[model samples]
Target: MDSKIKISITNFITVIYLFCFLIISNGTYISTAAKIFFSILVFFSMIINYKKVFNAFSLWLVIYTLFVLSSVSWALYGEFARQSASTVVYTTICSLAIPLLLINNKKDLEFFYKIIIVLPLIYYIYYLIFYDVPNIFDLRQDASNQIYNNIGLYAAYSFLFVMIYQAEREKRNIYYDVFFVIDLFLIIISQSRKSFIYIGIIVILSMILESKNVLKTLLRILLVFVLLFIAYQVVKNGLFGDSMKELLLSFEGDASDSSYVGRMNQFDISIGLFNQNRFLGLGIGAIEYVCRFVHGQSAPIVDNDYLDILSDLGIIGMVIYYGFHIYLLIQYIYNKKKWNKKNLLFFVLLIMLFIQGFLIRGYFNNYYIPILLYLIYYDTKTLKQDDSTILET
Candidate 1:
């Protein structure tokens, strides 16, 4: 195939699967068909790039999925376990692997990352066109007129992506300005508290990583809190409305409030369940078991991804599940030897996926695939060819 045609074909197939993922959970005809179809496309990509098939990173992906699948033997809900296995397979092969093989250079990385960053804005556009925008605008509906936190969470970090892009470039340009604004607008309209805090963390991390002066970074951190105070005092009511304001203040309430305690009781239950099967785990989506057998709820539906992964997958699963991320982190650090943008970028992503509520429960998908793709893409494209620079202008 001609180089130009090959690039176009690769990108086209990738876009199809990417869109498939955005709707893969709908349980609709299109959703089911798209997943199966795009999964086949993923296979085709793998077959065509068979030399990269056994790449160490790619093998780890398969191993990770197999472990998730293995949990079905002990899964509390076999169907959910199958679904979890299916998700890992789909995400691994389609989202992570295909993109990994396709992105062979800095140009590919920039284009792919740009699309990932813009996806949230595109989804927002779709929601505005299709959903009840008035209710969402007034905070009557879920933020972004969608039940999931996908838009806000992804959008918040898209700003950080802009910084990553900046790292790739010699200088900032108008694309940075436009994307920063679009990312901020999407995050704000979604009113996701996690997203809000994610942005704050990104800002602080950027200051700390990019600057050498300790005093300047500390002052920037302090200035962040000052600006935060102003936003709390004035911006919430005007921009996000009363509902969001109430949510913002929800944290300041008594920690022992019944609502808060009720929410955390599940976590307590999760810990107990983990102890029971600490080594092998209860299976993926084990929290649903926690919710059902223990709490009588319909689903696991917890916000904490770490607990969700730990309780369901257990110690062995934890090592495999997190092992891939650790692998990527080590690869990037080895390839890029500085306290670079990619280091802090990956750190923020790990924290979000680890400790925070970047949940699978209310998301189209987790950001894991994108992060994996990024880490691998950087390593493969720029691996220790001395004096090599970052992304193309």
Candidate 2:
């Protein structure tokens, strides 16, 4: 195969998926359409590029596939499970498509970074000028709380994109550093506790990684204080508006007012459900009915991804869910002495995924999980060989 053709096809597919993820941030119709197209792209890419098959079939990915199948098989209502299972299908396709289609070289990874950062900057601009303000502009009717969620997730994506890119390039470009700061700002403005926690963990772990000396450790401690003080001022100043405050504070409210407590109750039920089906799980989408019944009225969906998987997929599903994390930790340890820079980058990503999963019910989202997985896969692929630095450019 000609290198030019391969690069072109890879770049085109990469752009398409990045565009799809951005549009997904805006609404559901585009997201659904993008998922379908992306699936076709993955299948075609797989068939045409059979040599790349191994990239798609990591132990982690297989475990995830098994969990998906088990979820569908054990589903209390196959119809509802089928709908939820679409996420599983789309996720599998995207995960395979990533290492197959993207990260051919360091250059490709670098291009990926540019796209992730630039596109969301455009989206954030639109959000601020349009969605953030009322009467001045109106967003699509479907762009509601869900859109805000997409905003937070994409913002986190941008942060990780910058982190990995900066680490690999081994230079602190002012533009990317500024973008990281802005990413944190956007996260805070979004008033998403999950987002805050996502970056917070990254900062903490990065400090730990970089803190070889006592002075560096102290500086990191000071940095944390500064960040916390700034956050307190931001919240106290009411920068994110009443709705954001209410959402954040909902975590501490009483049983009557606590949406957070509802998720806790659901978590307890999920544990009970997991006990009943320790291995196979109740199957995906089984717990929505359970949640509905428990709440009496329709329970607003929970965001604790781990609990959701626990109740629906059980312990086996949890293993599948965490397979990538396990693989990543092992990979990091193996490469620890060779590349401190890449190790730190992987550490940031691992912490972000762990924190975000716990803080939000994000494990089953059709968009972000695959993106995170692909990012890790590509990072591993690139870091495995120093010569493949095309993406770093």
lDDT of 2 by residue, 1-393 (tens): 113434466777788787766554524687678778877877897789867777543446656766676578767667877877776666667667677777667678777777777665666676666454442122222354445555566677788777777766655676677777767666655555566666667767777676668787888889898987786667546575544455556644523335566677767777887787877777787677677655563464566778777878877787877777777767766765555565566667866777667666666655556666667766655457664332220
Enumerate clash totals for all models, in the order shown: 0, 12
Model 1 misplaced regions, further than 4 Å: 1-7, 23-25, 139-145, 228-240, 255-262, 292-294, 331-351, 355-383, 386-393
lDDT of each: 0.63, 0.66
RMSD in Å for candidate 1, one decimal? 4.6
lDDT of 1 by residue, 1-393 (tens): 113433466567556555656623456676668667766766776678766666656676678778877888998778877876776666665655454445665566666666667778777776666666665443336444344366786787678777666766656566566888877777776766667777877776666555557787788778878978887876446565454565555567745334344457767877887887888888877776558666785444566556666778888877876676676667655654443455556655555554454444421145345444445435444445534444221
Model 1: how far residue 358 lies from native, Å: 6.7
Best by lDDT: 2
How much is 16 displaced in model 2, in angstroms? 1.6
In Å, residue 288's CA in model 1 sits off its true spot by 1.9
